[model samples]
Target: MHSERASLGLQIAAIGGLLFLHLPILLIFLYAFTVEERTYQFPPPGLTTEWFAVAWNRADIWPPLYLSLKVAAVSTVLALVLGTLVAGAMARSRFFGREQISLLIILPIALPGVITGMSLRSAFAIMEIPFSVWTIILGHATFCIVIVYNNAVARMRRLSGGLMEASADLGANAFQTFRYVLLPNLGSALLAGCMLAFALSFDEVIVTTFTAGQQSTLPIWMLNELVRPRQRPVTNVVAIVVFAVTFVPILLAYYLTRGGSETAGGGK
Candidate 1:
């Protein structure tokens, strides 16, 4: 009876936590349609779609959205390439200080975002690099590389070395061995990593703020809107769009990784 009661209590606590986490998002979507302006009164007077149109028509929002997408795409590609190289070296090759290098790759991500932002800002300034889209990409890439590296490393660890050895023994060059033996195994992981990196780069604000000058991303735009209250409902519209754009890809990436995990485990 005590165990049953404890389990019931734990389940109730979990439900409460979930509701606490998502209730505000639910409220945002609900009151976004509420006809009442400015004040958030329960059971809004009426429902309206005006704010959705208003948010879509805003000229200021789209440019930032486009810029963010471009930065995210470019940065994610760069991170994937760089990260894959690092993951491959760490996972497959015996090198000096391999463990240290692996830790170094992950350190930027484990560090506080503010610290990373500050460090990037200082580096850019020291290098005489002006704040621009490139700067934002560089800043975002620091953390984004960790995502790709992690995914690639996990997949590489699960992969057997015998496959690559067999390919090489069959008279394949390094490039061909990697292409035929490793690349096929890594495809899903790389895809998942790229998607996750893109999502992170898209929504990153702190480092972008430190790196971007007179440039804004979608996340920055959202922050400005929240600070200067306009049609509050319009914020919700932006939120919904941003959430959909970012979360869908992330969810897909997660499920892709989960599939990899299952496949690897099944083979074991």
Candidate 2:
């Protein structure tokens, strides 16, 4: 009886925790359909799909959304290339201060978002670099690289060195070995990392704020709308789009990385 009671309590706790975390997100979805334009009402006076059309028709939304997509794509590409190279070196090579190097690579992500944003802003100002989409991509890549590096290195560490040795012994050149052997093994990790980096860059507000200058990404645009709302439900509709954009990639990344430690090496 005690064991059964404990299990029931644990299930209840789990359900409560999920609700606590996701209830606000549910509210966002609910309000997106609300007919009230200027003010929020509990249980919504009426529900309609009109806000979705309003959000779509708004002239201000498209440019920011396009810029965000562009930045995320460029940043993800850069992160994948740089991060994979760094991970390969870190996983395969041994040298003094290697651990320190790894820590430094990850330091940007470990720091608070505000701190990272401030540092990037300062660096740009000192360098006389203008804030633009490129600057946003640069700021985002700092942490995006960390995500890719972590995923790649974790997969690499689990990989057997013998696989590379076997490829070499089979008369495969350096490029051939990488293309035929390492690349296949690293594919899923890279994909997962890229997806995560893209998702993060898409929704990022803090670093983008510091780096954007006069430009706006979708999140920044949303903030502006909240501060000076033309239609409250329209903002909620945009929020739903943001939620979907970030959530899908993150969910896919989770599934990809969940069994990531299982290495594809040698015969196995």
Report how far off residue 103 is in candidate 1 (Å): 2.2
Superposed by TM-score, candidate 1 places the C-alpha of residue 171 at a distance from the truth, in angstroms, of: 2.2
Off by over 4 Å in 1: 1-6, 259-268
As a whole number from 0 to 100, the lDDT of residue 55 in candidate 2 is: 83
Name the lDDT value of residue 239 in candidate 2.
93
lDDT of 1 by residue, 1-268 (tens): 4454557889999999999998887777887787776877888889998888888898888999999999999999999999999888888778789889877987877777888888988998799988888889888887888888888888999998898889888999999988888999899989988888888888888878888878989999888988887777887888887887788878888788785553311210
- Indicate the worst ten consecutive residues by lDDT in candidate 1: 259-268
TM-score of each prediction: 0.91, 0.93
- Per-residue CA lDDT of model 2 for 1-268, tens digit only, reads 5454557889999999999998888999999988888788888999899888888889999999999999999999999999999999998899999989988997887888999999999999899998888999998988889888878888898889999999999999999999999999888888988888898899999888999999999999999998898899989989989999988987787787675563212110
Query: Using TM-score as the measure, which candidate wins?
Result: 2
- Candidate 2: count of backbone clashes, pairs at least 3 residues apart or interchain: 0
Query: Each candidate: RMSD to true structure?
Result: 3.8, 4.2
